[model samples]
Target: MRKFPFLLTVATIPAAIPAAATAQPVQSLDQVEETVLADDADDADDADATGEVEAITVTATGLFTRIENTGQAVTVIGRDEIEAVQGADITRVLARAPGVAFSRNGPPGAFTGVRVRGGEAEQLLVLIDGVRVADPASPSGGFDFGTLTTGTVGKIDLLRGSNSTIWGSDAIAGVLDISTRGRSGLAGSVEYGARDTLFASATGGLSEDAYFAGLAASFFRTDGFSSAAAGTEADGSEQFTLGGSVFVDLTDQLELFANTRYANSDIDIDGFPAPSYTLGDTSETQETEQLSGALGLAYYGQDLTLRASYALADTARDNFDPALGAAPLFTSDGNSQNLSLRGEYRLIGGLTLAFGGNREWSEYQTDSDTGEDATITGAYVQAGWVLGGLAAHVGARVDDHDRFGSATSFGGDVSYRVGGGWRLRASVGEGFKAPTLYQLYSPYGNLDLQPEQSTSADFGVEHGVRGSDFHAALTLFRRDSENLIGFDNATFTYANIARARAQGIEAELGVDLAPSLRLAGVYSLVDTENRETDNELARRPRHSATLFADWQTPLGLVIGGDLRLVGDSFDNAANTVRLEGYEVFDLRASYPFGDGVELFGRVENVFDEEYQTAAGYGSPGRGAFLGVRAQM
Candidate 1:
């Protein structure tokens, strides 16, 4: 990959990303439900240092519009919710949301990808601490969920549809914006579970009158899982991460902030030996290292919020084969650097404007010196209006890629409050993403690969207005995509030869039966098809549902359980391999004892239901974990 003075190209920056709504601490499942239904106020970082659960607000919007004001399908997972669903893997936690499906090659630490509304992983844009972390070295330039642990994350905002006007390229399917721990004082956890797995994490933060700083670290290791269906060897894995964030007030209305995170992982992989092109356990392993960080300044005025930032993401990978000596058989390195300036300002009565410009440089290189670099400059603007009981927002973006020329995207959404606890909303968004460097220049590269473009729209209705304890919503969504990029294994090359459509309905209901009890349920019916082949998209279930409930007993014992139900799916694009469906149930319990400490345990796959998400790869059956977590 070319090493150039990318930072010096700040002049290339255009109007780009703006701040989303900040998250407020949620204290219970009821509050979590309320957050999804409430969307009216701006807390500016939820300004409440009391650390109490406040009205759930969807604050990730540039103008801090409430959920009721936005037409897009969104789910916000906060720290309390994250802790409630205790798991090292981020994918498992995300599965609780509707229209979310994931596939893992074998056990944990394997190649994991998540598809939203039946959209491919590469179409999702992931941001960690405001830094885009997609691996440029990967053929799809996507972020892998396999190595990301939930410990360091404080919040997750999932927007389930295209909105490239705000996120720029790669926002075809959805956007996952994650923030690291911003909690005050000390907090962390330690746990031991199935497969002799050990996991631990620590986070510490100090908040002064004018400054706040935090540091976090986590380690995980697991053993005894075979990647190959017919193999007997255990493919172990281990990983660790270190991260920190800082915010300092430079003046009455000016603030400076910075964040950094690093992760390293090693996992045993399977391979097919010579003379046998079949999957089997082998002395093969993979190592990955990643780093992401950002630095920025913000000015907060009475009616204007402006921010400027510089961010960088780097990924390095190596694979080793014992039969080929001790040295790595393959290696790759890639990185992306970005500079941007964005802001939101009140234009007039009930009107606001959000605008930004961004310049990004990305490049990747393999061992064979098959390397390339590209730069993209983009600008975007969004206008929002609040008139009486109606709210609307529209946005447009234009981008110029050094290798793919220029493209334009537009999106619009509206929400209206009807009578009685009812709100109606609709949205339409468009996306345009250029081919990744690896897809265009690698050994199996296809020079003719075209950019992936898509359009997504959704209409929905919801109840849970006026702070009602019971909440329910139904959303209908559809997406049509063209020139989708995929690896052509038959010819051992990459191609833009696929077109697809995904249509689905998502329904969710929640009720706070009482202060001590809460129940939530989500269901999705995704109908997906390959327009070119007339087959259902691989690995996407036509039916998926999840049920969850929690109770706090008089004895101070908290118990909770969740069940996931999935329908059958095809393993290959041709739909020849059938993958059976399965259900998994989990039970969790916790009790407070010492100061700021809680003992927690969970029984996963209680019935030991054996399942396979992929054709030959088996999922973990029954497992259990016990741990302790503390917070001040």
Candidate 2:
């Protein structure tokens, strides 16, 4: 179910641009409300002409823009692919994309970090329903993918490379945009699998000519495997999440909306026990709760579009050790209050102006230290031109931090149709990641730390016919970073002393073998170096690839399978410990009955492979699961 990516060239715009990307007010209520998801039906003017639904994407440059209108390397995964995996982990879905790598500390619910284009995990900016969800309490301020289960999420969009000019800070690596179900429908799924695993999720929404509302919830629990490679005790994990969105049209040209999400998780963790001082089972546990929401209003005018939002993200965590008593060994709390304002104005002669401003105040407190806070104010503006046979955009941003002063960034991209069905794309961008509150004010923190900075460039070409199901793209990218933050063993503190470079090739293609069969493949070749020590960065495989195939039978049965290949990589910064590469295969199938219900099942790790992306961590073995899904 790959979306068959396309690289639109400037030559394709001899005609006018799509209204969905313009400032004109839209008439379709669903189109207006679904903007919460970063995409809308009015996406472009080509949808009606082609009679095929057009997939859209949002940009930091301006209002929600059409995918074909941008030059960034972007990947889109819809609900169909999520269900095809039939798994609860989101990292599994993300691994299928190019230029992406991840390392999990242990099993599900453990800490997981995703790295893009040689950039550290903490450099990526993640947005859920437009809320920046990174945990400021973390040492590096990175989101844990292991805690992100595939629940009511209906769409995922990944932008690879630096986009700081588009989103301010925290975009040195890239950006991951996730959206929950936004369409009008009733859907649910229940599954029971190995290790006493249970997963259940439900989503429902109602949409009218003037309003749209939706709710979704999911629960997951597993009597998991031992996290320690040498331990025999089983660690368990449990999680619950609930989210909802509401949109009401105040007028034909104005809309009001609210979005919120809540999650709670408890996980049993293994620790390095005394005496042996090695990873082993211990009486340790962690409990965490997260709440994020936003209230906003959007105005759609004949020549200008404006949006305003007030959002907050709050997280609290507690860790307990039996040896230290049941009162809890440690605790921490983090919160971010944000104000966002953005607009896009369409001018005459195929010119558009995109601008945005943001203000954020973040605070973090732990039992070990007093609470600390910081504020950041930023603004950016970009102009796009759709001339007869050329398309391009250039933007600049300025961000000022209460403690760290100011930093400025600039970026631009272009696309041109060279003729035939081929298009050429190229982009150069600058990005930066500010030091987290914990990094600056903690007991081991360093006030002298500066923001990590990066400069990235990518060039590629793609070939695909608009009406055809066949598509292919190849890109070459490189990124050089400075002032990267890392723990200094000698100083026993965090410092900005690392310099690095990451360069690689990404190739992807999708096609239909038959009317009922589809195949897709993505391959990445990444080369990374620490520069300081001349060693490859840990846990990033030099080569990786994924293959996907799906078949639809005449009897209405849908069968799908995917294979993953990873090359060897080091598990430690000094390259003293090696982690062998491994292969894992998975298969899933679903059959529709009547009454909007379907039965499905899946097998994971068909070969029961033994391998680890992180040393001393255990990987999942063969497992099976069965489930039923309902749609109404």
Candidate 3:
């Protein structure tokens, strides 16, 4: 027998002003310079209002196409939007996106988890400069948002829903594609804040007719508050990051490029007894290092393009206990390598075809667990068509894994404009996640576990007021997952014995009231349940919403505020431990000085509302920061 649970419907008023345009002038997030022959020139004038732009997106289909023309639910966050939020970490910035839910154990450097549409953290795929960077050694094979900062990032594109047919592997939920800064210029910033926190960064780049190079580096340190509730001892953290990119134009049609990023951090933490909420006296230290690099070449023809790339990611972590002497308690190392070839050709009329193949190899080793390795090879092909106000896409992929044998996935979507600023779209996709190396080879592993599989669908409608600054969208989505891997209490081993269903509605609105004032809002209502026990998924909020506003004054001053709300959720799978939800308010202001200089300040948790994303963990209270920035 199967059961479908329904959730209460909540009414929310739409607020206006696109969050992406709050920091700068009003512009469509999807707008891109049309360089391809298939671009629609007639609709260029209405791009801003309709959320349609000429920008090219590679993640949607492994080929460059207009973001508005792609039949997928997507959002783009550019540099301006990033700076406008003025967040110290990537998790804070990402939380502003619709349908995104995140939880952190404690402060900025603590372990963090992100999920989309009630999916597990590991189900989402993360790419930095086209290189996969998830830590295979981690229990969930997921990327830690705590280690990432936005100082070197130029743009981010988030594609929601099952996209494994194009991204493969862990893309059972969605894909987060990040691009580093590659333009010419020099920029830097210095900041000081509460808790004796200090941050500084420098970035420089050069772009010539045929050659370009860019570099960025940053340092951060803070004497943070306690990680555990009712604890007096304070934990601290420090991190250093460096990134660089280089591009060479070998010929009019051929180019070569490379990108590299490295991050290192040291953090202090508190310990807790098993199954208890009380904080223990044991103090611990953690050291982490991450590196990612990619090198690629591309040959561009009149109507055809070909590309080849190689990428690598490595991560290591060591934990130590001062009370137990100098010997490390545990250590882990993980690495991944990928080689890919892809091409795109323009067909007759407004049709395009894209195909790609990839080979992936990964390994994980831990001091307490035996090491493991695995390899996978995959190939995919997709077709896209765009004519006037109508767009369509279809793609399929097959992966051959050393342990799981083979699996195939497919997806398709269609979008159409119905005139008078209305657009309708729908999509259905299939995705799969292979068992991680740890889940397959560890002492508690299960060799006979089957890979997790899912089917997801979404229907949406959008309206943009012509000749005005108002845009809104409503989306309905559902996902069904089977063969979910979980620990078996009786056997003390992992097994694929659970199933889940998630359904939700997402609403968003943006409006610019005047040239200097803007407002944006997002709301999501989700209902997720585990089929085996007929209970709600742990730590997933049923309701979440955000409201943001920005104002630019005549005196060259900019002010912004954000209000965020999260509903209650359970902390345990049995739905026995309830966690209370909370709301937080934040404010920021910036003043421009002469000669490319500016002064900025921010206040976080303005009301000092005490809250926790994890039970027994302490979330930050009211805090303030001041900074200066300069660019050329």
Candidate 4:
């Protein structure tokens, strides 16, 4: 489960920045270059705090590596680890990453889903700014992250495996690129907590030479948590958002950009715990709205940098009331539009070349008894290479679906440095996913479903340590999937006899030990199978790990702790109930009084660990929260 909405998209080059760099500042969501440059492109050392992480301009990978040379397995969660972990959502920040596995149907924005390495979840491929929003009409095509809301995020990049060449189709178990935050100056913040939590946001920026603008807004609410069955509690939501961006400076070459967004969410679905929470019929009331827009144009001479973009998204869902009496009361709508063109060239010395093409159109509608309607189109191309430190990449794609007739894929990756800071990587990929529209015309579904394919490979190694400023990485992965469509409990629909195979390994480490004391950890191991009903693929858990430590003492306070563990899987998949494995603990502390206001507190699942990765659902046990943030 990955949900990012923090904002970022900076395009700079005019006047080469005040003299020779040194004007690119403005990053402090707790550094690390906002978690490894939008989902694993790695390496961007400290940079003395801010200046916007030295001109940060990562819209999520395009065959670029710096996180010590991107050796695959990536993870980055900033904003001070999401404000010292307290009711931290986004699947608890990807459970502190590593192999990754998430599932939640309740508590803090329920109905969440994520699975990597062990694949599943529409074989992963999520992006917000660089396009691709999944759910072309979920029949298992993925993208739900519980309807997203990380409170106008500012950072989150988790890239684990696969990556269909240069992003095309569901990247088969990998690819999560979400970037936001590029409206220049004017900061803002506000907060309130505990069950009825509240949040506020603001951003600003404006440049001249032709024109540049930026703006952002946010509002949120929650009234949930506390329910162990019986009458039920946890079920409340509210949200509102606005975004903007405009750029035009067609001089030295040519440049133009525009973007807009609006979002709304209001949900009150006290619907859970079947067998009658208050009276069997699960309550429901929802309203979901979204409007998206984008336009782009870029052209730079000398070394080349050509671009074009067009994007549009419209989504709506309204269901005033429904308690499952007759089990039907609906309204659904979806729309998607995209067009792309890109070119980047610098072939001579260091080498750099890129290409792009994309086209998409989608639609969905509903009246009641479950509805359907469809259309789709696609195209792709990509390439990259560099000298000196050595790097290489390739891509390919083809998609045409009226009912799942066309599909094609290609992949590649390579990196090397092998010197002191170390670096070595290898990646192979192939991805494809089509056949949605509720699995081709839902009537009882199954219009001879098909289209679900994947192939993957990974190899990694990374290291950095010069006089004690540590960093590390290690990864190994494999995946194979085919067809995969489920339904066989009398729901009457489809069956492709399923097929899955997964293998995984991920490890990470971090350290700073001095300045104020810091340490980090992540680990994961998995093995999943389903070779056609042989069992073992459900909630997937073979092992998981996460550890953390932070300290900064000299009065101003700032302490932390974090730990997580998971093991034991199989909630269903004919494996006959077997979900046990858990370990959670979190703690935080903050104290500052130099104005800008800051008094934080947190304690989550401290020692209270019940277990269940979704067998009967129902999570959030042992909790605590406290908050305060103001910068006026």
**Top-lDDT structure, candidate number:** 2
**Which candidate leads in TM-score?**
2
Against the true structure, candidate 1 reaches a TM-score of 0.90
lDDT of 1 by residue, 168-204 (tens): 8998988887767655678889999999989899988
Better of 2 and 4 by TM-score: 2
lDDT of 2: 0.79
Tens digits of per-residue lDDT for model 2 on 152-266?
6777878898989978789998988777665567789999998999999998777666666778899999988888877888888999999888877788767677888999999
TM-score of 2: 0.93
Cα RMSD of predicted structure 2: 4.7
- RMSD score of candidate 3 (Å): 8.4
Clashing pairs in 2: none
Per-candidate TM-score against the hidden true structure = 0.90, 0.93, 0.91, 0.31
Error of 2 at 92 (Å): 1.5
Residue 396: error of model 1 in Å? 0.5
Q: What is candidate 2's CA lDDT for residue 484?
A: 93
Model 3, C-alpha of 520: deviation from truth (Å): 0.4
Give the runs in model 4 whose Cα sits over 4 Å from its true position.
Answer: 1-73, 76-84, 91-140, 147-169, 172-193, 196-327, 331-417, 426-428, 442-469, 472-516, 519-549, 552-587, 590-600, 603-632
Candidate 3 lDDT over 242-358, as tens digits, reads 988776668766667677999998988888745774774348989999999878776656556667888899999999998889999999999999998876666655676777889
Model 2: how far residue 222 lies from native, Å? 0.9
